[model samples]
Target: MRTRGSTAPHLWRPYTQMKTAMPPLEVVRTHGARLVLADGRELVDGIASWWTAVHGYNHPHIARAVAAQVETMPHVMFGGLTHAPAERLARRLADLLPGDLDHVFFTDSGSVAVEVALKMAAQLWLNRGETGRSRVLAFRGGYHGDTMGAMSVCDPEDGMHRRFGGYLPSQVFCDLPRTRADIAALDAALDRHRRELAAVIVEPLVQGAGGMRMHPPEVLATIARLARRHGLPLILDEIFTGFGRTGTMFACAQADVVPDILCLSKALTGGTMALAATIATAEVFDGFWSDDPGAALMHGPTFMANPLACAAANASLDLFAGEPRLDQARAIAACLADGLEPLRALPGIADVRTLGAIGAVQFEAPPDLTVLKARFLERGVWVRPFGDIVYLTPALTIDRGDLDHLLDAVASVLREGVPPGA
Candidate 1:
């Protein structure tokens, strides 16, 4: 049997340099907002399982739903047949979302959902007999996903996928429109590239995994307006900022803007399991509706609309409907502001900002992540810092004590000071 502190040698970790990186810790169990390690020590989960477990780990509602679903039906192909869980989830999502976003395409992960959205955007034009509209206009600091179609639209020069620039197809990139000049430049670029542009994709408010960069709601509104003016479909990558992460149920709501396509995952199943959805507006869906089967969107994942995942997502939506999740997110934002904002004056800390349930403390320069991670673990918190930023996206249901503990641990580590060198 594998022992504590020793991950299986054969297993490769994501975004890790195996040779020098620290060994992965063995988490024996999780409950609420805490992780129980193999050696019996508990650590407050500062990132909420990569911002998925909004209602905390192993919530009874989601667990019970999954258990019941497993007994009745575990797996089924969504290619030809439809299941109650998937159908119900689709309806729930359509009703919950703003505008006419009434269509849902299920996928197994966030990345694949993004790929599906991109496909829909591209194919929408093709089905309309419009050629030369193959490229997408994506924001500079945006991150759609790791899949090929999604990667093509991500930030090309500075994004994590830049290493694959030689392999991936090129897409137009622009900064999020912030000022009048920026908006005008974006408008000019859209007009210049109107012939080749199929869609305009962006991360509504917060650009997660792209340095947690943020833009105001007005910026999003401006982008949406420009896309409408150009008669181009807009795609919103809300996989990270959806479900109360940015204070509203959906980040697009803050701007009163609805996209033609919206990708969602992460916290869709309350972080209990993998499930994702790519929803489209009525206008986008109409492009694929025809007598010719060739007009159909031809991509489908084998595990599309897995019954178990759908059940979990349905239960997660129930929690959102029944519980005060939006209120919880607001509370978290206030708490984060109170706890982390003071650290801005600390040496080495460049900026501190909070939105809804998210908080970030960016350093002037990249600190020694390995040393900082060790210090956080020693202080009994699971805080992962990457590339000059130490951010928090804890579970919305995390109790004040644990939340305070997480903030305190981060403060203690900063007080000790980050070691020089990356």
Candidate 2:
């Protein structure tokens, strides 16, 4: 019911203080690696629409699948019925993921997927008659999701969820391991809190939404090892790092570590639809396989596995199987490293880091984001900087010229020196 040239004043956006926030840009349509505005101007999408469109915007394969599915069945209740799209996607994911991550539970978004993972961890203990194991052990720089349960596991002191610390369930937190001593500290902490913990959760390699922080694969391996040693389930939140975003298909794979539970979303549908899947190992699933119906996982979302969304996800998997996405990711890493690393020498620039397709330039302090955001748009590119960093997670299929243009815009903006402010 939207009219042309309408601003849609009734619509509210996320993470914005509307009273002071500027009007958002109106996008008319999207194609491969670019967004066409209402005014017909094209801007290179620097973050792939929040890192979801891995196959790029309006991909033909995904579009065709969705269109066909809509004509047949747009949606159906998942409570009592079943569908082919969901069934196929679950089997496909079970085959794709590492180890025995063989069971798939669908949800509408990443946050709910995370919420389900936490619930599974908690209930897994309760189902086994082990009471009082309710808390989770999380990391300091990790970001899980926005739901209350997910927020509880995010970086407690320094994360965006800090204000809600008093209201959420308190979970044990430890700094990400870096050295032998740090590992010892984590080992000791695990031993100290093992009795209260139901699971150990982490964002495997890159802690997305927590300032784009990057830690080594070895650190992730050590955490997994410690969790196993403590006999606690490990939950890997791969919502931001899965589906080739971190060079390899999954960040944990870089360390050859597998988790008891894994959460996936974002590029699951190639950015065409909203969908997420929480896959668990047989061990975790078996915890609920009892004759007692009271022990069953009683949570379910209204649109747990919409047929259209599942079709899009299945089509996305087809592309991954047919394309050289990993190679493209490696190429993007090289380009990002070559372009952003030089900014480390610039004044006020604290650090520059690149992993797989993600590139970040951290400032000694956050600049005026309102001004910086407009500047990027004016330069015919789209980049949204948050916290103390301006980063890029462009589509893996972006052409070399478009990628260079995005890098040029970022470099020019930083070169001119961003004025220090919020």
Candidate 3:
């Protein structure tokens, strides 16, 4: 086993080892949308710590709820016993989720949630005597998670799955249908692989980890229609797009479509605790409902439905009621869109896309603004540059001052140059 000290230097870094890379930023403390660095400087959290901290840092409501739950019952085995937190959370989620996606299966993270959804979809077909349908369909440039099942569905061309090529299962990759021709290509691909395909999974409206790629809701509606036409199960990985990230509580809701199975996490616990849920419709759940133990879904993590995570999720859900989070998200989206308008005229800029609280500015590699990443960091903002794409995915609770600071930092970076040796 690789000890912490033995592999820490190589494995614990982000970006790269040279230029635009160093040890991870040492955060001494955080509150709201600001991070207190070990050097006593505060930096606005531009990426929301990989788009997870929805309510930002140290949210009182979430903190209180977690503390209260921990004081009552810290941990318990969820196999044979039940808890109020878990039951209530499940009920709350059922109420929020569209249609009959009421059955909830808990997992430790978004990757596990994707794994659970894929397993359930595949086994559902197996239980129905359609064992030949084992292949999965996913879009090119789509990122589900780092797990094996997720890697199978993700685009291996992205370089994350290169080392795991031997372990990943064969999955059909379809072109992201940006235009009519692209959509036709997808239809053709599906027609060619329909016999072996079990399910078609997508990130829906916005592909976050896939360089914040934005797609119209109509495309998703088309995908849903195609899935239904082919009798293939559709799994929507809303782990990053859920909880109003795409201007809707769920991305599928925006398109007036629901999937056979839905994966959610990241913001489910208000970014307080790690929790993921795979929701399925009654018909899909029926496949696993059997008297024979072997027919049941034979998968679950040890801390599947930890009560503390459930409590945090419950509290996070309550924030949506009466707080106008969706409205706030819309306002922030508009603000970010307006803020990024200037970058469109900048040289070497390719595209500027905005959806809800997310905005991305793509630039050509190795240009004048190529060093904008280091500049933004020097200006006290932690904006991440995926290849040449610079994006802002701030917490919904970000104040106007912090938002302005982030925008100004980006503007300065585009205008000036990065600090010396940054």
Candidate 4:
């Protein structure tokens, strides 16, 4: 059992060096965009718990829906059993998404969703007996997840998975679209590797975890066109950019293109619980529809479509359906653009960019994220920095005052440099 101010040595933390790290903060409660610490301090959550909790924490509607579901049923085997929550959420998502991208398959989290997407794309060829098409194509600055398949395609120089280079599958990578929105190099690369390509996958508008990189809409449009021209499947990983994070419900809509497969998670359940979904077009689903059992897309997570998660997701989507979600997202984007504009001129800052509710400030040199995050925590806010970037993915429900507070905190930290004695 955990007690106040106790740090469990047994727990292993991800992306942490551990040896020199401080004990993790103890959070006792969360409501709206604020986190209540055991020490009685309240900190505004700037990253929204890794960009989830879009509707804010402990939303009444979502909490009630989930509680009601827990009373009836929490989970059941998804292989043969059917339930109301799963069916309802699936339908809601089908309607919410654009085009024939309607068929939804539930998973436990975003990384698993990416795994499912990779499998779905790979099986598209295997189902058709085209065994030669085994490789996948990805753009530079793209990041999918921590799963092995997802890691194989992340930016190679990104220090996280570079050490495991020999163990991962070799995927063809293309350069970021350069001047004149030209992807002639991309086209040539795809053509050169056409015979072995199974699909072309990317994070549509904004690349999360991989430095919050932004790409032009025209570049995204051209990617879809090239994928279609190459006769390969296109999978857009919108796990981080979905649910109005990129100023749209889905980033693909910005380019007016529909992908063969779409991965969603993080904010799917309003940050109430861990859940993810992989939605595909009918055309992609049809490829695996066969009499041969081996032709099926072979993947299923044990807790797939838990009722509580589905209920939370259903309520979360309901809020989006009835509320002025796009307006809120636009307001956030506008605020971020206006507020962050001044940072680019600051010393040691490389650039700043804002998309929808997302804002990023990249430093010319690496700053200790742990130290910087602690600095933000001291100012009663939570903002995690990685690599050369410190960014915010605040809840869309955050008011202008709180939003300004977060920006002010970032600016203050940059100006003050590291704390006096830390």
Candidate with maximal lDDT = 2
Candidate 2's C-alpha runs over 4 A off are: 1-6
lDDT (tens digit, per residue) of candidate 1 on 1-422: 33324458777788887677678989999999999999999999999999999999999999999999999999998888999999999999999899999999999888999888878988988898988888889989788888898898888988889999989977888889999889989999999999999899999889889888888999999999999999999999899999989999999999999899999999898998888999999999999999999999998899889999999999999999999999999999999999999999999988997889999999999899989999999999999888889999999999999999999999989988998764
How far off is residue 331 in model 4, in Å?
0.8
Q: Estimate each model's TM-score.
A: 0.98, 0.98, 0.93, 0.96
What does the lDDT read for residue 206 in candidate 2? 95
lDDT-based ranking: 2, 1, 4, 3
Single out the weakest 10-residue window by summed lDDT for candidate 3. 1-10
Each prediction's total of clashing residue pairs, residues at least 3 apart in sequence or on different chains, is 0, 0, 0, 0
What global local distance difference test value does model 3 have? 0.85
TM-score winner between 2 and 4, please give it: 2
> What is residue 131's positional error in candidate 4, in angstroms?
0.9
The collision pairs in model 4 are none
Q: What number of backbone clashes does candidate 2 have, counting pairs of residues 3 or more apart or in separate chains?
A: 0
Q: Find the 10 residues in a row with the least total lDDT in model 2.
A: 1-10
lDDT of 2 by residue, 1-422 (tens): 23333377677678877666777788989999999999989999999999999999988999999999999999999998999999999999999989999999999999999999999999999999999999999999889988999999999988998999999999998889998888999899899987899999999899999989999999999999999999999999999999999999889999999899999999999999899999999999999999999999998999999999999999999999999999999999999999999989999999998999999999999898988998999899999999888999999999999999999999999999989884
Candidate 3, residue 338: how far the Cα is off, in Å: 0.5
lDDT of 4 by residue, 264-359 (tens): 999999999989999999999999889999998778788999989999999999999888877999999999998888888888888999999999
* lDDT, residue 80, model 1: 87
Q: Give the alpha carbon lDDT tens digit for every residue of 315-422 in model 3.
A: 888888858889888989999988998888877677889999998887755343335655777889988776557789899989999999998888777655332221
Superposed Cα RMSD, model 2: 2.2
Could you give the C-alpha RMSD of every candidate to the true structure, in order shown?
A: 1.8, 2.2, 3.0, 2.4
Q: List the residue pairs that clash in candidate 1.
A: none
